[model samples]
Target: MSTVHKAATVSTGEDRKPDVILDYNKTKGGVDCLDQMVAAYTCKRKSNRWPMVVFSNMLDVSALNAFVLWSGINPAWNAGKTFRRRIFLEELGKALVSPLIQRRKSVPRGAASLRMLNQIRGQPSSESIPSTSTATPPTKRKRCHVCTSNRKKTSTVCPKCREYICKEHSVTITTCHKCM
Candidate 1:
């Protein structure tokens, strides 16, 4: 029982609403707007842990709120764009993870990962990613100097060996601070 209501009141008429409900309904507009944004796009993941769930929810709401504040301040920014929130969220996610991606020293194996890395960096998928940031990576794939098998093609050079090496022959090593 609510302190304000004192006791549950039986509705004599179908049109009657409780005083508590009326007070709650006053903020329904903002709640509905936030709900719509949350439903449309969210960072939520499937999990039973309450802390992760709460953090994900907070992230979703914060992103939407940030979008609102940004748009309100920059009147001309992304003008007349119908799906501006989606675009904003996408860019924000990329910007957040970009530094980490750039700092990664390991060259992940597999074509899919390479393609994803290239796409994230706004480069063509066919191009090679920097392995250790020693020298300017060659535009063309060179024959692996260390490859014993039928000469494997590679663009990455080994930082440890100081020689042209394919994914098969190279070990992941961290680069210097200046290189990073």
Candidate 2:
């Protein structure tokens, strides 16, 4: 159905409502434009569940809004590409879940999926996994590596030094994402 209506403007010899509705109502016109843009490229599916429908709509709208913001912020990005927004959304989707996929511990059972996971892992063998196996000191007990021989027999081996260090000697070191 058309939004236009035959108004009394014909008697006044003017066109059917100038077509400048934004000049009258600003925000509602933006809402309509946004709705139209979201409909063009949406993740929405035919579902009876209202929540899923709402969620998909939210995703589509937010994605469009984010694309607009990103384009405005970085106009030089993909400067002359015809499908810049679509490409941006595709890359954004990949980036959103890439960390989760990269950190996946279990490899897929299927050959293709396993290969894909391996490619993401960038390592052929999991050989560097530190062996948590503790060696029983032959005598009675082994002393702690730190704390002046305090009786804390933490048998965790230091991965780097290959030494049986106690909790006191162990340090949990972390690095930033960019450095990694």
Candidate 3:
């Protein structure tokens, strides 16, 4: 991408080329032209001692570009009462705005494709999912021999102690948390 600004100097009767020319190599999926334009504006403003910042936020760059281009094609589009002269633009203006609007509206769909690819890997069957909703209540168990004083219900079977304990006391018999 390249930009050339030519000014006809009335004082010298000569055509003056731009003091700054920006040239960028074409890249795949890189920042768009509007971002570049914003950068250019920022760079130009920075050198002029313009105390105020030119552009700071990641604005709707494409909209700004379209607006600027529209204003260029017809000064009446400028921000002010002058715009009242014409509410809209001619065919030439539409031609210029269409591409910009399309570019702004366009979004990369490759991410969706990537997601689709990931989903294609595999999906588990319904049978793999245990049906806790209709699952039968767990059967009650006996108390742990180590803590014979407590008679509590649990899930684990402790062959070493030959006793069962509720989930809380199951640990005394060296049983699992599910047993306690």
Candidate 4:
């Protein structure tokens, strides 16, 4: 059996409209080209809360706009799209939490400091550090080796040099001191 296909008619005259009318009107008040760009690259996941979805979408749009602006300002900064987006989001996240992390790191007077102090003492193993699960939390702040600031307690000890440091002095997310 053979199948037949109908050819589209070509309109040519003052009354004729382009076969594809490129409906910009429908898109005018809705999601624009930029929105499509952001949606294409956005990361999304299922969530129980509607607010979470809205927040995630907003974040994606912001990131997309940031990328576009940055690219416009710095032509030489071009990198692979996926890599650039990942890096941008990661850095943004770090920047947003840095202040809070610094605050928390400054007030470390609990099991965290104890762990650091134990590591600094050159103990061969965790067995050497006295485990005080039931002990009361320390009330005083410990000094940071990097800044030597007694204003804040030490958050973690540098694994490399075994020096106590506040969260601000920590190099990365792992909370290792800059000396490492």
Alpha-carbon RMSD of each model: 11.7, 14.9, 18.9, 16.6
* 3 or 4, greater by lDDT: 4
lDDT, candidate 2, at 68: 98
| Residue pairs with backbone overlap in model 4 | none
On residues 46-99, what C-alpha lDDT tens digit does candidate 4 reach at each position? Answer: 999999999989888888878778778876663646577667667777989999
Look at candidate 2 and tell me the lDDT of residue 32.
90
Error of 1 at 91 (Å): 1.1
Q: Which of the two candidates, 1 or 2, achieves a greater TM-score against the reference? A: 1
Task: Report lDDT per candidate.
Answer: 0.71, 0.64, 0.45, 0.62
Most accurate candidate by TM-score:
1
Winner of 3 and 4 under TM-score: 4
lDDT by residue for model 1 (1-180), tens: 357666655545686876667656786798998888797999899999999999999999999989989999987888888899898999999999998988775746544466566779899754554344655555778887755668988777554323456766565552212122
Instruction: Judge candidate 1 at residue 146 and give its lDDT.
Output: 59
Pick by lDDT: which candidate is best? 1
In TM-score terms, candidate 4 sits at 0.42
For 116-159, candidate 3 gives per-residue lDDT tens digits of 44457564333233344654443666554345565555655543
Candidate 2 matches the true fold with a TM-score of: 0.47
What would the per-residue lDDT of candidate 2 be over residues 76-110, giving only the tens digit for each residue? 99998999989999999999999888877554353
Off by over 4 Å in 1: 1-19, 105-180
Rank by TM-score, highest first. Answer: 1, 2, 4, 3
